[model samples]
Target: MNTPADRATRVQDIVTVFLLSITAVLTAWCGFESSKWGGEMSIAFSQASSARVQAAAAAGEARDARQFDLQIYTQWVVATADEREQLAAYVEDRFPERLKVAFDAWVDGGMAEDSPLVVDAYVAPGDAEAADLTARADGKFQEALENNQRGDNYSLLTVMFALVLFLGAMSQRDITRWVSRTLLGLGVVVALVGIGLLTTFPIKI
Candidate 1:
């Protein structure tokens, strides 16, 4: 019922549709992957930033607490037993009291990502406010320290999750399998390095 030329044209149209379908599918798949990767990257960045801020806060607070303890101890050294007891009681009340207030301040400030302002708030130099800042620094330092410590863990987990997500993104067949495997391995290595850096880097008190 059909001429040879008509049959040939029909076949060509079918082939064209097939090719276009393949391309569309591939594009859609890649777009999905890209979106996922973007999300993971964003989450990782946020967590890393938060962790850094917390670490700084914790370290600053711990140092301040130590210094406060030292000052209190110094004061206790020259005082009478009754005076020392009074001072001890005062310190017990004051340090904990200030700690509560400073902690509330830190949290109310939104536990934001690390910035120069946050660091400056905790560790300013050559200022006569060291005495006043001691409590604040101690509180922030402790918060930051705890965060850094947890950051190591969080970073490691995120790296692992990224590796998995990347692998999923590369669901194409006929490519070298080694490429994906190699990327996974490299991700692990990168995660280890991040952990090492966090562990080895000494924070300023």
Candidate 2:
């Protein structure tokens, strides 16, 4: 009843079950990780897209501001004393009242080349806000790129899980111990790689 062949067969069965159980666990873990990464990627993409749209709107506003700057320069170049005063009034009306001090200084200096109004130092607050949005959009795009890469890494891990499941299943069917062992070993190697990737790939949940 306790024959060596029966005992050996039982041992093989136990080993097969162990391998299958381990492979199933690994597959489940990989599937969950892939899902988590995918979700993060979507969120990142949405943020990036929203930032891009806001940045575009800000850039458009900046273009309008730049056009106004050009108009002011043109008026200053051609205006008589009365027209120059009118141009100054127009600039005051175009921007917030807070900028009057800077505007007055710029005009008192004869609108010289070194005028602070020509640069961001005295430029409208809206223009500065637009510039900030452009920089923010670039930063969002970079984050989206990094998240996409992390999603790809998790996707690759899912593929590796497939292989592990396949090879481990094959080990259950192979008649020779060496063949079964080899297949199981290959699965282990793939699982190891997936595990290593898990350590490096970014994830939140």
Candidate 3:
């Protein structure tokens, strides 16, 4: 034998409890996803840093190898210009394998290029490997940034859910029925919007 007002109050209480429960679960899920994405971001950043260091080392090796090749090639040029055939031969014989291949190609091409350094075949020892590692580092860095953004999105959603929870709690307080209903309505709207946004975000285990 409940009056209409009593029945309405009971309905409000039920709606508030439902909203609070659902909002709490969603907030927890958002927090968990944010943490997972943060961990993924950290791992990606670490991998990126490791790759960068290895790339730098490899690039340094390539630079040093190229410098050595340049010095040997200069010696060969000077000996050849002075018509010192034996000295030129000695320098040529000691050319690094990469340089020797390019030198041979240059000679076969009637010495058309200014130097074997310009030849396509003259790749420094670690040049290709360094380039590959650098690309890998760049890719990992970009991935880390994307992961960080995803974590931020989840954090924002967690805040949104928290707001919904607040609204739901306020709705359950002793206030005017209309005001209570308004707060509950707002909480429901916010929760729906949050769920929509959450669906758009990627999930990370």
Candidate 4:
């Protein structure tokens, strides 16, 4: 014949088993999510690095193009000041399409206020592309930081679930009934809190 104490002990054992099992699964899930978010962060960082390199390359190209255009414009200016029409025409013919547009606009404006280099139409090659690539790199860097924070959040939940597992295992000891029940109750409370926090995190996989 099972006494009331035996029945209560049996019930406590069942609840402890259930709590341990559920908390173990939740712990594993948190670890998995943390790993996934870490991978995402690495990938985002790599993409940001690649974009930064490309942006730097584009900026270098723009600088070189601008310098070449300046050299050509200086030659043209010297030829024009010396009244060498043929030399000026020769240098003007060699102007890149980008510089030619600005030069034509400057000439049309009576060459009064600003030089071709300062003209609105004087966009060096790769300038816009470099600016766009830089913006993309900045965005990717921000995304990487966000991913890292998400991974950290999941890691914290994993630690919380581990504490719950510890408490649930301790409840199975040969302690007094009330003490065992208290440990089990604490474990359940911790597990519930961890689950609530888990719900708020973004899922990566």
Per-candidate TM-score against the hidden true structure: 0.33, 0.75, 0.95, 0.92
Error of 1 at 59 (Å): 1.3
Model 1: lowest-lDDT 10 consecutive positions = 113-122
Clashing pairs in 4: none
Model 3 segments more than 4 A misplaced: none
Displacement of residue 130 (Cα, Å) in model 2 is 1.9
Per-residue lDDT of 51 in model 1:
53
Clashing pairs in 3: none
For each candidate, what is the lDDT? Answer: 0.47, 0.69, 0.93, 0.93
Q: Give me the runs in candidate 1 sitting further than 4 Å from their true place.
A: 1-12, 73-205
* Cα deviation of 54, candidate 3, in Å: 0.5
lDDT score, candidate 1: 0.47
Q: Estimate the overall C-alpha local distance difference test score of candidate 4.
A: 0.93
lDDT: which is higher, 1 or 4?
4
Worst 10 residues of 2 by lDDT: 92-101
For model 4, what is the error of residue 36's alpha carbon versus the real structure, in angstroms, after optimal superposition?
A: 1.0
Q: How far is 161's C-alpha from truth in model 3 (Å)?
A: 0.5
Q: Pick the candidate with the highest TM-score.
A: 3
3 versus 4: better TM-score goes to: 3
Clashing pairs in 2: none
